[model samples]
Target: MTSEPVTLHLTVGLPGSGKTTLARDLATRTGALRLTPDEWMQPLFGVSDVDGKRDVLEGRLIWTGFRALRGGLSVILDFGCWSPEERWAIRDLAGLAGADFRLHHLWVDEEVRRARCDARWLEVPHETFPMSAADQDRYLAACIPPSADELAYAPIPDPPAGHETWAAWAAWRWPSLPRLDLS
Candidate 1:
């Protein structure tokens, strides 16, 4: 019996770098599920303070995505995973689930990204977080793009000395999370 293998489409980019657009397109093209936390946050929870609650909100959505992937569906997580540690964590997740992984790391110039974000805010006020160039700059400043090897599932370097990584903390946060393979 041949079981279908699945892929995890990971988005890595600044807040306004077209991650969701690409994720939406990938989902439509591949018939995969697109799990975008920002979209969920607006509906489920009010947008009083979107940034303050994002980490918690995204954690839930990612858990759901993992469950979906386990059920044999391709998932596109449009979470704007900005840091290399964040990407590595999800890459490790794909590894655990035996899913093929792809990084859709969108790169746009700051000016262009800011313009796109302003337009998006106008187009979908409720659907998108209000973004400013300053916000985008902060996000881009913090981003650590994956090296070629990290994107390729090659052994990645350890986090810097004395730097307590978020991924390390996540293991504790979701201690019961299990790896799954349908095939």
Candidate 2:
């Protein structure tokens, strides 16, 4: 058995619940690859989130993360996986790869979360997101905290076979040169 050190770290909580901060810290300490959709959102589309593409982009990241784990590299995804289904899928993936999985749920008071969100810009100007009360409300309403056992996770529909698609590790193959037939 390979004694490779591989871990899958997932953040679970609301936006302002310090997921990113914790993710950053954990990644730094553990030398894990931190994947944050929010960090990519602003630069990619000039907005925090774009219609139709956010989920697709996140899915791609998850695929890449599994690839990393397969290589025995630790991965930290700071996507605030709020649903049991989401968390369960990740946990199952890690188990399949024989990697340690951890779910860090940032429990913060509502008032404190709001304050943190409000102070983000001033506190961390370089990495500020435009968060509104409406956004917070929407996220809270949609969030499904993991319950006891099951990692606060529930069964989610598994992706179809061959669902995890990725580029060949060799990167790409060049087309064979066509032979010139001089008759």
Best lDDT goes to which candidate? 1
Tens digits of per-residue lDDT for model 1, 1-183: 223368889988876788988988888788888988778788767562454566766766677777787778888889877677778777656766667788888888878888888888899878877866676677778888878887667874564455354345444443433322223
Q: Which TM-score value belongs to model 2? A: 0.77
Error of 1 at 160 (Å): 7.7
Error of 2 at 79 (Å): 0.7
lDDT of 2 by residue, 91-143 (tens): 76666667788888887998899888889867865565777889888988999
Instruction: List the lowest-lDDT window of 10 residues for candidate 1.
Output: 174-183
Candidate 1 residue-wise lDDT at 146:
72
Off by over 4 Å in 1: 1-4, 48-52, 156-168, 172-183
Worst 10 residues of 2 by lDDT: 169-178
| All candidates: CA RMSD (Å) | 4.4, 9.7
